[model samples]
Target chain A: MTAQSDQTTANADRIIISVDAMGGDNGPSAVVAGIAKSADKNPQVGFILHGPEETLRPLVDKRDVLSGRVRYCDTPDVVSMEDKPSHVMRNGKGTSMWSALESVRNGEAQGAVSCGNTGALMALSVIRLRKLPGVNRPAIAILFPSTNPQNFNVMLDVGADIRADARDLLQYALMGASYARNGLNLKRPRIGLLNVGTEEHKGRSELKEAHGLIAQFTDQADFDFVGFVEGSDISGNKADVIVTDGFTGNVAIKTGEGTASLIGALLRQAFEYSILSRLASVLAISSLDRLKKRIDPRRVNGGVFLGLNGTVVKSHGSADATGVSAAVKLAFKLAQSGFAERLAARVASTVELTQDAVELADPVPEHQKEGQA
Target chain B: MTAQSDQTTANADRIIISVDAMGGDNGPSAVVAGIAKSADKNPQVGFILHGPEETLRPLVDKRDVLSGRVRYCDTPDVVSMEDKPSHVMRNGKGTSMWSALESVRNGEAQGAVSCGNTGALMALSVIRLRKLPGVNRPAIAILFPSTNPQNFNVMLDVGADIRADARDLLQYALMGASYARNGLNLKRPRIGLLNVGTEEHKGRSELKEAHGLIAQFTDQADFDFVGFVEGSDISGNKADVIVTDGFTGNVAIKTGEGTASLIGALLRQAFEYSILSRLASVLAISSLDRLKKRIDPRRVNGGVFLGLNGTVVKSHGSADATGVSAAVKLAFKLAQSGFAERLAARVASTVELTQDAVELADPVPEHQKEGQA
Candidate 1:
């Protein structure tokens, strides 16, 4: 316990977070609220909320809580959630979101958090901070709600790139596993590829090829590769880390969110139908509360974009104050963990090995394929 | 209310159902229990439970209720949930699942319900029932739990074909809309194409192309076309029928299932943590019950395989007696509505119109390009 306390203190003192004050539904209010809550709890951490001075000043002024530690950076433009990705990347100079990214890039802040347009943020992060060496496309990793409160599952490429090859999937596995280990404080995280089925030939050609690559690496991989997992296995905690392309991951996340809300609404309606059932519902209130907290979206607010040179966290655009605060805390923890540096080194080593293997398999000409090796 | 009752009674009598007795966790016992319950309430409906005679005889022997209406078909094999699709299709001749499908095809039953291996069942149905002329792929459509109890949302291609083109999605929209009108008893079900955003250019190439087709048809089509919908919009009943490819749809449905279960588990834990919270939960029991009834998986047990020549409902493999019974009721509703015949005729007409339009523009290809022309 003492060693854990010391590590927490050491991490808190070294971490600096840059929050996009103009992002999300509640804007600077939620961002400021989250920062205030986090700062109050962790005295060693500091924050810089980027936005227009006039809009952000009052929110911070209302809270005398972290007046000294929480500072502000002025940026006139506010990027709306509906903005086009290319437009945001090209014209978002001096904007709050861009400035927040700049803070991480320039080393003024160790990490950044945003609840703005995901596409814009991804474009800006890659353009500004750049991808880690040997990483072709940076992927976003989200900790999806699982049955076990302490055993959350991480899904990668949750709307980063639409298309990914076998190599990209392999990189996602490595990055996601690393995230589970460092960010979630898990040792040798169990990784699984999200496929149509557990069978080797169950999915598309790309997945079949990826299965081979994953299988090859898992035999001697650094992490504990648990093999393929299906959609139903996600909530069952079949694996600590689940990896997939952005398209499937995005759809899966959205589906889970929609379904949970739908069920919750349905349960509410059922309880209201009759007086006798209402009485019975009262008897089952404890059971209901237990379910709510387990699937509370706010409790797991922040999702990190992996394979980047620095830490960048994305909160839901519709996030409230509590959600924003959680994002800030996540950003702080990630930055303090020194994950970027460790991932950079690991990825670099993997790339080197891959390059050497490719060179060894040097091809002859296309004409030689039929008769020569 | 009197008119609705009369119509429902008339509709119930015309419906014929074939149930797979060897399917599900509890097999014939649960199937028989559910059948007994339904048969007792609705004397007009007919049922045939297909399975091995020895295994099913004892389950039905004790129950005197609807003994005449409930008959059996001797089948040698049973398709387990985990059975390989190819293996089952090739080796499992005269299986309970195959025979149930065959009953529908032979006109002995209007529709069939199976709580068996979903993939294997789907494969058998596709091969035996055959697809409607002009239809490229058959899709699975399930009514999802919605925030509105009176109006549930429909999602298609939950686990049918993995790769789908624009035309297939267009077919899904049409079939789903028809199902919504018939199954949910809606006058004009609003159709929405599920994409990443409402923007025309937001999704993948397939979505972008599908969006154009939807826009063109919705403007002059028979149904109420409400335009695009996101993953978040599914639960809100923003659209009565939401259409997408099988892969995306399956992942989304599973995600929703997992998240709901996770949330329920969490709420239970919360209630058990302390006596005070448990007491508070009791006070809110009525609300919880209301919510549970609305989201009950059993209520929406049957999923229709659209674009097929005949009606086929895929019941959940893990379904209990209540769920199997609900599937039968849903299948009955679908058959009585004459939804398949109507949908078949509609598709035939649309395909003809599409072909005519293509032929008319064949001589002047430039005129076919609407944007340029």
Candidate 2:
């Protein structure tokens, strides 16, 4: 842990992270195993596991580390991986995924962590917790592997929705900056709007409008607005938070992940191609191991959904026990530092400027203004 | 050279590729140096160097491989990297960029290759060569390093225009598939539309429309339209051609290039970190060399401008001699196989479909229809 996290822990109250234990590809076993790992290390952490008592109790009981650290909620239904978001919304009332989020909504849990269908989890989070005041759209923020002082940089709107207007993009910059400040522990997280070019004249008109809007909030939001950043700057230290419409962000993240996976596969093939290369692989095993660990997607396993009354961290569905543990740890950290409340406060304060932003670029119709308000 | 290129040369005529020998980052020297390299190995390939005759003459005289085989066009004007496309179009006559394309326009050269500003090159290529009869907008096509049989996959609209409607996307599919068939020598190239997800119901609305349109063209274009593909397929061999709006493609390609560069930088740092690692590096030199060569950006150093009557391959402005040589080779291959005429022919065959696509998508405005026609 960094000194900032240590300082945060010293002042904050005990944090409980609710766990959705049923729908992950690895099932309840991985969730229970993850809870045990978290419980052993963080005494101030507690879990409210949501699943069928019959299925979860046996797994929780197998780990002595989870004893007295967990409280189970008997939710029998499970949202399958193939379930549509609309279907899950209508039928998911008694499911573990719904129960876990409801715990946060009802103030029973500080934050929720789920390894479920992304669309389902996002839909449930929005419907359960509702958007924060002044936030027209909630965004899903994730940490990309980086070469900065911080090992990760925050990127947001990774498919919460396919669209973002000038107003939504500005909101993302603020929300992403808040996440970077509290989660990554940057004092003034630098915010960059993702565009095709760093040049001022390039890209869509919305981006140019978003650029000016984000710039105005730098002094107010207590972060640096680092103009436009090209896609290359996402992994570099040039920006702490890279903001974009969910459509572009989603494609960029998937492309980076896909490229990394392809490179790993190619490296393996190269190593096994010849006896001399195989010998080299054996000799350079330590350095090669370091490289692999540095780029392993599993290490950066959680995507935090921001711009809501309550926070939710979506772990990868196919995550192993270690990945689930990482997500839980992230949720615990965000909860302990009172991130959800502070983020809500931040948005509420700057919201009038958000309205000002809309007026500046696009005027609201006099009749429609009341409805939007 | 791959067996494919060897075959292309065997059955093809002597090809002449025009070269814009000024305004690149390294100036005329690098351009001349690059032409020398391409001429030495490819016997049937020739060059028409365009620039100020006095400055370019000395450099061509330095290379014995270029004697008697070079054609010079005395154009004193040069397009600086800073010049805007609009500025170039109005005042760019006599510039090397214009002369290079003009050479192709007049049948003095089969294709044009330039390392000038991309926007300017694209603009000049459009104004001088004009769009192919059926092309609504010309796209900048690039070859991404991939694990395909050809070691590359073609991606288009990497920033020719920020906007692409359903009709424009359909044109890209037809144009890209044709390029893949001729340039990559794919009998039936598989085309994928870049999107946020592979699901039938995911992504923006135009994507759904574009998907349907491209599927309709698979039979007519003699290619396989492989529906939607996520970012992962960009580097994988899942599709031979990946198509998207210029905004998304530009960011994605930059992201991929930046990520690959970042990984390369990190790998070097890891290898040099410790004495044991340095020893391992010595032993693993062969494998590392192969890996380095495989991923080098210079090796895949050309972006082909499609949808124009003539071909113009844009090389990186700061590219060294090897990179420039790669661009020349690409231009030579396209020239040898009559790619420009073939691509124009392909789009001409689909000209009726192009009109149908626009009408199906959005009824043409009466005033604009005549101008568009």
Query: Which digits, one per residue and each the tens of the lDDT, describe model 1 over residues A1-373?
Result: 0010212333355467888888688767888888888888877677777888788878888997766665567888989988898998899987899999988888778899999989899999999899998788899998887653346888888888877887788789888878887877877777888876676657777776666666555533478777778786677677888888888888778877887776766666676677765775676666666566556788688879988889999998888877887888888777777888888887887886654333344445667555644
Clashing pairs in 2: none
Cα lDDT tens digits for candidate 2, B122-202: 999999999888678899999988889898899998989999988889999888998888888899999999998788888
Best of the candidates, lDDT: 2
Alpha-carbon error at A120 in model 2, in Å?
1.9
The TM-scores of all predictions, comma-separated, are 0.89, 0.92
lDDT of each: 0.77, 0.86
Cα deviation of A150, candidate 1, in Å: 2.0
- Model 1, B20-138: lDDT tens digits are 88868877788888877777777767777788878887888788775666657878789987788898879777689888888788877888988888889888888889999988889
Best by TM-score: 2
Task: Candidate 2: list runs displaced more than 4 Å.
Answer: A1-14, A361-373, B1-13, B354-373
